[model samples]
Target: MQTPDQIWNDADLPTRRLAGLALNPSAPQDVLLRLLADGPLAVRMVLCRDRILPDAVVDAVIEHPDTYTRSFFARNPHVDPAQRARLIDDPEWFVRAHLAEGPRMPSPARPKPLPDEAIVHMISTYEDENMGSLGFYQQISTGLRRSLHTHPVAKVRCWGVGRWSGLSADARAALLADPDADVRERAQRHERYEDPACMERELPARPCHGRTDILLNRALSRAVVDGVLTAPAREDERATIAANPSLPTDVVVLLAADPDPEVRRRIASRADLGPDERRGLAVDPDPKVRLAVSVHPELSEKERAAIDYEVPMDCGFTFRHAPEVPPAPEAVRRDALSAHPLLRRKAAGDHSLPPDLVARLAADEDLGVRVLLAQNHPHAPAPLLLRSFLEYTGRERAHLTTRPNFPTTGLAAFADHEDPEVRALVALDPETGPATVERLTRDPDPAVRAALARHPNLPPPRLAELLDDEELAHVAAANPAWDADTIRRLAAAPLDGRT
Candidate 1:
């Protein structure tokens, strides 16, 4: 068996392949445990912190000696939220802190609510000291947040007092009269909300997304509404305020015909829009306003289709990674079958659409519809995934290739393709010739060369050559053809070892 030292004249402590080995879907359970126990930071990250681990690997990672590894695992997004409880009692503060923050980017779907026991523990026992704005994401789940007031633990119920601005009037009164001294005290402390100057003082001198978010969250006093709506120079602020849930009836009527198209457009999104308001906005001169009102739930599919809404085909269109609020399943079903292409596009991104709908959207005429289906739906057919990958070159374009059904075995045929992006797919195929692998190592495109450098079939001599080539060394080190002894040599060596 060739050693890593034999693979390179002098290789820097190699980890690129170690990381790759950790990501191999076919890697055995023991291999994963070994990687978690002995792997470098980069290896541990991919193995324990990125992929969902089997039960054995999960236990090993939970008990791993390295604080850094354990801490990273605390926040691993791919695993069950219930599994996060394994560390709930872990002594490390930051580990508990990360658990408290929930998974990173935890969206595109509402994360399952943490089991009530975990929430009760976090809400009752912890200080809010380490929590930043995202720490407040605890309040984001409506059902869970609302239930906090009824919790058996008084300290847990105390956290609910902080949501006074968002509470139902009945909820506020209940908290104020609560048996728990702490909960009642906290509720009383929030009474400053009655003083409109408190809200006025908190408003920033300049408008920002944060200020806009604050405006949207709180019910503005009449004085605050007057100050906000009078900002003729601040059209954007006025536009954002137009959609505030707490906007009064008269203000709602006033903003419905505000001079700025964006203000009217915001008004169009309001659920409380009267019948006359919806009809008028449906014919607004700005295409954006009509587009906003087109999907109003009150409107029939036929009525929505009749609106002159434009489905964007602009070159710059990009998919939003995680829609903050996933459309209701019924809405997804409705849009999946809608006459309008825009409505179809909305359905295309919903992974929950049944197989029949997934298939229909996979063959959609709109390019955005097809690409979104490919990017979002796990069961998107191999052919559709391939077609969408080729036709679309926008943001997240590369994400399509990583789909589970993306064809890899036969992609060797594209070895000589014109596009370097397509040419790179050749390396992913298991059957690519050693000759093709060697040739692509010198290809014009660095991405193509880098990908091909990691193929198991790459000629060992050329693999050795790339180990010395700084540009490709990391990925070349990631090649999986090295024998067990060679891998052990690399693994046993320091993460920053010299060849």
Candidate 2:
């Protein structure tokens, strides 16, 4: 029953400091304003840069005596145009220079376009690459697209041949005769592909689902339903067809009796089932089918009350929360509590479960299960998270230390953990104080030092030291604290050279 502010106030100095820094810009406005007023200088500096802070916070930060503090508030997006114009003539040259950058200071650099050959490789080699989407391809200018058609690289020409709508007969012949196999293949594929939209509009009269052309037509007409039905159904395709919301009711009913349990499971999830079908599926032989029926939207509240179903917590229905009616029968809750370690672990992740269940799972015998409970459960005890960090080993311990909400009460102990991985995790944790991060900069493990270099809260002086490390330079180049000029210098430096 303790309030967030009370909990925050009771925490040790280190814990309170870390909690302040770890708060996202989106933290409730009242808490952020309180931290800005009473928190330590480091906490206040972080709040000054938060772009979403209310105008009141912005006004206060801009008036701070320290020029460096005022400079940060100047760059924040929350500053109004009037404040921005005032900063233009401020005594601090840094503030004025940054304000002069534009209405938006620290403007993000526009990405340089990829080289033509690189663009070709991106589209021709990877279908899943988002740049290869139809909308992006359509945006290319006709003149620039024509240049690609005749580009010196065969891959570029191959990509062009696939998309060029106005290819001449002679040009198609020449492409087919091209020595590159990719170019010839692309030309042939385009020649054969009639757009699916053509079939959707033109083939309305045809049996939609069964025909090969209907497979090409993504149109959701009656023809598509007939094709899905009349076509010799493949087992792999049946599950997808069963899940399609647009499928005719008769086809959905037919799929309910599908020999494949997965297809039947999919059918049970459909939203348009009748009362009889819901009742019939409620007693299905497959436990998964019955579970799906229990939670199906089509199952009425009246029907749900009438059924004598014993639904387990592991089912997707109640994975995140328990059901209201029947209130997760006592027997089901007991089974979840005593189930195999795996089920108990899953049950612990359900935030709506009683606090006692979460506590039990947190202390479970299996380290992996306990780790899951610690990382996932909202009510997972803080002492439990801290204990795992101290006693456990491997990635689980590392995971506990890196959690943004990881209790910082005993955080200092792990900052010097003999395990380099735990030290690295602590160094990376936003909640770890600057002193610990500074200590870890000299950590024996280079990887730990590298992680410290990536910490957003790293001071500029510490970051400059990280730049001197050849191995950490690439990672350090990505830090937002450095201005464009500094980044350019960093990028221009040889990869093998020290700062």
Residue range 46-117, candidate 2, lDDT tens digits: 466444566766666666666656665554554443454445446776655444332232212111222333
Work out candidate 1's RMSD over C-alphas.
6.3
Report the lDDT of model 2 for residue 331: 36
Q: Which stretches of candidate 2 lie over 4 Å from their true place?
A: 1-227, 233-235, 283-288, 300-425, 428-448, 454-468, 474-499
Q: Candidate 1's residue-wise lDDT over 1-499, tens digit each?
A: 2222343333233665566557655556667788887766767765766667798888888887776677777767778877866888778886787677766643333344567677777766767764444543542456667677777789878877876777788988999899989888888767654545666676666767656755776556787788777763255778877877878888888888888998999999898888788889889999999999897768887778678898777653234444445678887888888877777887887866799899888878899888888888778899998888788877767777777899887888888889899899998898999999899989999999989988899999998777557677667766777665555554555556344
The local lDDT score (0 to 100) that residue 453 gets in candidate 1 is 88
Query: TM-score for every candidate vs. truth?
Result: 0.73, 0.36
Residue 201 of model 2, lDDT score:
57
Q: Give the TM-score (vs. native) of candidate 2.
A: 0.36
lDDT of each: 0.75, 0.56
